[model samples]
Target: MRFLSLIWSNLKRKKLRTSLTILSIVVAFVLFGLLCSLKEAFTAGVNMAGADRLIVRHKISLIMDLPFTYGSRIERIPGVAAAVHWTWFNGIYQNEPKNFFGSFPVEPEPFLSMHPEYVVAEDQKQKWLQTRTGAVVGRTLAQRFEWEIGDRVPLTSPIWPRENEEAWEFDIVGIYDGAKKSTDTSGFFFRYDYFDEARARGEGQVGWYVVRVEDADRVAEVAQKIDDEFANSPYETKTEPEGAFAQGFVQQIGDIATMLVAILSAVFFTILLVAGNTMAQAVRERTEELGVLKAMGFTDGLVLVLVLAESCLIASVGGLIGLGLAWLATAGGSPAPSILPVFYFPVPDMLIGVAIVVALGVVTGIFPALQAMRLQIAVALRRHA
Candidate 1:
């Protein structure tokens, strides 16, 4: 505490250089924060997914179709409460390539009733159930495009294109909101019956089944039973928890978790070099001042501690600022609907950031502090003279 003034004054001696070094650290940690957040977003489905919900898809892959009649059999399973099926509709709007969002054709009553976590008005529910061409959109999705109830939404899907390749138009009968953060609130869902009848081909095939289990603890048994029932069939079933199902899609891309770690390793390594250089330079320039401090009765250990403290202080301040900025950038309500999920800067990552700051400080300070400590009082003064 007593040496704080001296340390701070020394730091400010070359204000611009210190500021730039701090800024570099801030940038490095900011990247660290953002990268860790990105990794979290990628795996959020597995971490935050509901424990009771199980998904049944084709054994081969999600791209393959399952028999539509399989839903009734899955619902009849002992531990299964209900099963709802959905088909992907990769749709584009207004011939714009960038206008992309999730569109699904699902059994209205079964789908809505199975997932009560999605809140929709009774009147809107009734309206959606009644109208064949009705669509229910998520509140986030509706708000993004400024859509209102009763407005027409036209979407064109290459997978289920019309005979003339015209867009499929539907009325917005309801707007739904997720009760929990895990529930995706940016989706477009409409009746599978309407989609089946209107599509050019492949009417009896369903994409995947979302099964709600009566007991959360029996999810594994239920999944096993579901898979066993369809074994040896033309389209064998593979049942997994909701989280694993979502994770499967990400895994198909590549080992993103490993890739992120490698990237961060490189980033931190570069920061170490930059920070070390800054500290070494600071120590070199302050040789005369340090000699004066020794003459003024400062112990060798104290002088070493002072140099280390200055490096740690600079890194700590910059690292904290970087982490703060990263938190702000990734905090919910950013415009990255396509890539990022609803995510906050994770606490473990922040803790890791703090750890990095301290480690970097030590790494950058060790050599310089050692050099300062080993300087002979007479030789240092003679050199300064």
Candidate 2:
């Protein structure tokens, strides 16, 4: 405790050099934190997907449509509890692409029933089912646009333009909240029947089917049965766990996890060199002072401890600031949904950063501490004179 100030003062001896070195460490860890958060965000969908659910999509590609009637067939399969279908609705709101969110045309009854995670008032649910052009939105989506019940929301789709290419209007009938942490309340759902009736093309087809299994452990068996049932057909089906399905979409861009690891590895390697050089230079400049302390009865081990403490203080301070900034930038509710819709700094990531800081301090201090420990008082005093 008494030597804490001494260690800090030694670190501050070359103020500009120490500051620049700490800044470099801060930059490295900031990149590390942001990259780790991004990797987690990319896979968040998979982590949050329902364990008892499976997704059935076109075997050839996700973009290809499946017959809407497939939902009925999937429901009949053993171990299958319920199935609901949805098609992608890429609607531009009020001529702005930035107002983007997930818009799906779905079967109102089965879709809402299957997703009991979405809490909707019974009266609102009934209204959404009864009104032909009615839509239901998630709580987050409603808040984003300040939409309330009975608001007329207009959307235009290049894929399914209306007569004379005008926007399609929908009456918002319900707002739903997530019953679970995994649920994403950032989307819109409308009646598939209305979309089918008014669409320019691709009628009687659905984007995909979400199947809930009777037992979570039976998901793989149910998925296999669904695929076998649709095998060799015109639209041979592919069935996968809900998590795997979400991860597959992320994998389409590239291997993000691997890329992030590689990037961080390079960053930390550079930090190690910079931090190591700073420690070595600091010990060289303080050689005489270290010898005087030794003469005053500081043991070799004590000298080692002092050098290591200085290294740790620099690493810990810079690493914490970097991590704090990263969290504020992405996790503190900045509304850039397109990029970081599900991003937040996880506790495990912070723990990992802390471990890295400690390890970096120890590694950079080793040789320098050894040098200080081996210094002879008589030789150090001679060199100083």
Candidate 3:
């Protein structure tokens, strides 16, 4: 208790410097929090993808299409549970390109059956499947466009243009909420028949196919089997686990995770230098007081411990404040870019924040503690006079 009082007194002796140091820590940690959240958002789909699902795209590039007939062959493969195909419509709602969202032509019945994670009413699904020009929208997309269950929405397509260059129209049959939190809630699905019938060419092609395997452990083997089946075909195939496919998309944006780690390392090193200098100066100024205590029978180790404790306390308090502010900021939610729709605070990250604080405390105190321990009582007393 007495040791704590001594550390507190020393810190209170220089209020402005302590406050400024704390503020610097706050700003740095806030940046750290933001960076980590952005990285997690970009990688969330990979981390949360279903274990038993696999994605099959074109061997050369995702932009290329595959034969729609391959869908049935994949479904018949051993250990394959279900399969569905979808092709990107690449449409715009208006002239503005910034208002981009996913628009895809899908096999409605098979798609809903394979992806049970998309929550839609049974009656609504039946209605969507029965109607030729009916559409099902994601919850997020419905809110953005103010679309209702019976509204007829007209969408402009860049990839699939109509014969008269007019906008395509569809009835909104339902709005689906994602069954899982990680499922993307910002796209709409329409009938493949509606798109196929209107197309002038490329009538029997799909952008990609998603397959569910009975055993997740055999995912790699099943993926190889799917690819091998089409090795000699005109449209080649490449199959991977759903998680790996999501990760490939993130890799296309460059190595953001590695860049974030480097930035954090640089920031922490700067914090260490600032904190170490502050503690060294504080101990130097207290040389005469420490000498008096030593002459009055205080042990050398106790003086060293007192100085170290002070440095640790300053770091810990500042770190806690900074971490708390970061938590609050993320919890409240911010307007994230379309690429990072699932941004949220994670529990493991908070624990890591605490660990960083303790590390900073120890690193900044070591040199000052050693300097105080090595001070000679006789020389310190002479300097005091």
TM-score of candidate 1 relative to the true fold: 0.84
Give one digit per residue, the lDDT tens place, for model 2 in 293-360.
99999999999999998998899988988988887876554256545565667788889998998999
Which lDDT value does model 2 have at 304? 96
Superposition error at 15 for model 3 (Å)? 3.0
User: Which residues of candidate 3, in runs, are more than 4 Å off?
Assistant: 1-6, 120-134, 139-152, 170-181, 199-201, 293-305, 332-336, 373-377
Cα RMSDs, all models = 3.3, 2.5, 3.0
Candidate 1 lDDT by residue in tens digits, 1-385? 9889988998998899899889989998888888777777677667756789999999988889998999999989899999999888887777686777789999888887877777899999999989999999988788778999999989888788975667899999999987765456778899988888888888888999999999999999999999999999999999999988888877987787899889888988888888899999989898888888889998999999999999999988999999999988876553676455345578888898888889989989989999998777887888878
Error of 2 at 247 (Å): 1.9
When sorted by TM-score, best at the front, the candidate numbers are 2, 3, 1
Full-model lDDT, candidate 2? 0.87
Q: After superposition on all CA atoms, how large is the RMSD of candidate 3?
A: 3.0
| Each prediction's number of clashing residue pairs | 0, 0, 0
| TM-score of each predicted structure versus truth | 0.84, 0.90, 0.87
